[model samples]
Target: MFEGLSHLARDAKAWPFEQARNLLARTLRIRLTDAERDLAVVLINSGKTAEAVATFPALAKPVILETGYGPSGLPHLGTFQEVARTTMVRAAFRSLTDDAVPTRLISFSDDMDGLRKIAPNLPNQAMLAEDMGKPLTVVRDPFGTHESFGAHNNARLQAFLDNFGFDYEFVSSTDCYRGGVFDKTLLVALERFDAIQKVMLPTLGEERRATYSPFLPISPKTGRVLQVPTLERHVDKGTIVFEDEDGTLTEVPVTGGHVKMQWKPDWALRWTALGIDYEMSGKDLIDSVKASNQICKALGGVPPEGFNYELFLDEQGQKISKTKGNGLTMDEWLTFGTPESLAYYIFQSPKSAKRLHRDVVPKAADEYLQQLDAYQRQEPAQQINNPVWHIHGGRPPQEGSPVSFSLLLNLVSAADAQDKAVLWGFLSRYIPGASPETHPLLDTLAGYAVAYYEDQIKPNKAFRAPDEKERAAMLDLRARLAAMPSDCQDAELIQNEVYSAGNDAGFDPLRSWFQALYEVLLGQSQGPRFGSFAAIFGLPRTLALMDEKLGG
Candidate 1:
């Protein structure tokens, strides 16, 4: 599907932005006008309302695109999809139009939401354990703050994006919305309260009772849902009020038929209120996005356009979410590989597809560099012409010798910190005795010292002996490793120790040391070379790891 679209996206470059009109005609198996295609990218890039603005023959106002996520828990890979895609749209519009138009990417973290389920793979697993099945709205943070579970989750999301390198302004429902920016929209939604209630009640699968809030409560509110200042309703003023438990009413001013609407209707209201043009979301929200389109016509406003991308599936076949805690974290992945690899993985597919078992960290940096090289060298047609290029634009490798991780770490972690000559000398050994071609990603290793080696030492439980001779070779290597000299603290001693271990195990001490070590450490008979492994991990950690393994 992307292969075909790339052709159009490329050609769309030559034609009057009308190319987006025919872009997905054949791919999505749907027919749309040039306006629709342009609107789709404009919407997907900005939000529904932004697309409407982009279609205007004259400049009306700076296009507004409000991107938001429900802060159910810590931000997950899904959150990145929301913000990054929005950022890409903004970037693309700037690139495509020569900066004649400007875009605003507004991200809302729905910290006001109640906790649903704990994300299975959040870094602080023990912290989120108590709130696994609780309401996110009511759940207290790990720090025992008055902040709800969603606020804490939002903070994590904020940190995640900061780490992932997204440049966008973030708004928390707890902060920005509380100021009453959406009061008119909320009131308009409030007026439709009963009708919206009727529209939603039947869809509740019998688990929900007939209940209504001046605000949208996805489920029936049992206790104090109305206690918060931003959640209460004021009957006398014909408005929803925010309040404290003491019942001090914080009135939000409202107007513009703001007193009636449901979630779907409100989506259209939000677009008009914020002047949003595009917003990309998951397929789960298809019905919601569709309903907004209809409500837009009813309200005499244009519906913001949207693109629905697929969900990421984890190894367990469950959708990957920070709340689920089942997939990789941006932090964990960056430890073993480059940010570009991650960007490549996420941008490789359309927003709606699921990525499973995407490896962020390998056992060593060489393997990671090799993979990045493969991705870099891949044809433009292969990448689906997405934001991966927006990230790494196939730049040539940085000038340096290809050194194993440990040696490179040594250069960076050295006490002096500025020994370029020493660093170059260590890097020169990937070749038998000469320096090999350094990988572009190799420069990232010094900052990842602990992570690179820690990943390497993780037990590869799938290891098996080669043949009889290989098995004998492993045993000899083990014996050699058992006989390290009392005062041998240098890397050379570590290398000799590995060599002796191979000799004792009855294997030729060539590349067999790597296989032998693999059998010993990972239980696999193959892995990165021995010297390279030793280089990244250093003598102390490597020796300690071996001692823990062989007890010698």
Candidate 2:
């Protein structure tokens, strides 16, 4: 009899030595929540424990976490979210443990899934159309890069995951079935077919239930998966008889990769067989999760604890779809923002649906910078909940010179800078001697801001014609800015002068004044803090922008 140990433990240790060393050095106390503590209790209840020490580790057994991606289209931002969020939880788990418990995240790709429709984004749609209803493993890669469409997409997915240096194990459904890794679970599902059907049928439509079988055998004749009605089941022999697509009755062994279960059954069986402790799905799958949980229980296996997160929405509030291509792509996000920003976006309230679009990038990037700043200024206790702490996995990077994305955007706009060196030229004026190497984040933000300004801001550059009172305000602001000592034009002093100029212009200081300033100068209703912009953009250039907007 084979005693089951987590594949993660068999293949890898808890964390590499450096990571373990960093975890031990951290002094910040991260108290586990009741829910997180309960997970440890469940693991102990499952009878996997290490020897008793003065302080108990979180679990005796290695924790198995998984996130599934359907490789039907190119990987996108939504695909990255699941892996990012799961990694964060794994990091949180380390905070509670003595750094002995092993954890692994499975980045499972369901590439064996049948190609039902040609994705709109892929090349060579006609070739894919010919292979419709066949497993993705059998379809030709239109790009001619890999042996099959599934392999090509799998490579793309792996490349994207690797780019982030995600610590995960990759699993392929096709490989799992073909390598007989799922043979035992397949037999169990075949033996309890009727029981699993009872749990699944109520949620499905009558037409679907009428012909549905728990297992789908790939047609030996046509090489397409057949979803016909089951005719007979020989549980003892591990064989199922079903009608093929040609209306011929066929007998196939359930084991040795002859068949795979339908999605809901497969989900439950994978949980049971893999001993997965945690997984997450979009809220739209709530019913499916419920059905799968019941199926797992009927199979005499405990279902993994699950988290249901709200789906990402497009700018118009429609759900982001890989097929629709409505939301930002992984490349687009990385091009315009930092990986840390995307991680921070996923770290926000996981249960809430958030918008992902070009409009949201600057704010997310700036918030990431702000949190990075906080990690330096705040006490260790105060930094626990900060997103940067989680983004960096407990050992937050020591903060450098903090620069906001909005300020960088304005600086780029003011200087018309195209590269980091050009932007650094302007940045050096403010910090006196800083270069891109001394402020890596500011260097990165300079590139992001240049791209963002060209894409998002340049096309919408319509400076409003200020009213008579507003023109007076702009002229007043320009005069005050010109008189300020070049050495004294720090953010705070510059901000105070802007406010005084507004007061001197005779407009309500609180309401219309600053907004009018932004519209005239930046051509946006709001912008980076006027003081910060003035300091970074240089007082001389700031006076020039004011004069240009006022038609001086």
Cα RMSD, each candidate: 10.3, 7.0
After superposition, candidate 2 runs with Cα above 4 Å error:
1-59, 509-511
Model 2 weakest lDDT span, ten residues long = 1-10
lDDT of 1: 0.50
Assess every candidate by TM-score: 0.58, 0.88
Per-residue CA lDDT of candidate 1, range 288-407, in tens? Answer: 776666555444455655577787677676877654567777657666556655554555455445545533344334443454445456664443243343443223232333454444
> How many clashes in each candidate?
66, 0
Q: How many backbone clashes does candidate 2 have?
A: 0
lDDT of each: 0.50, 0.75
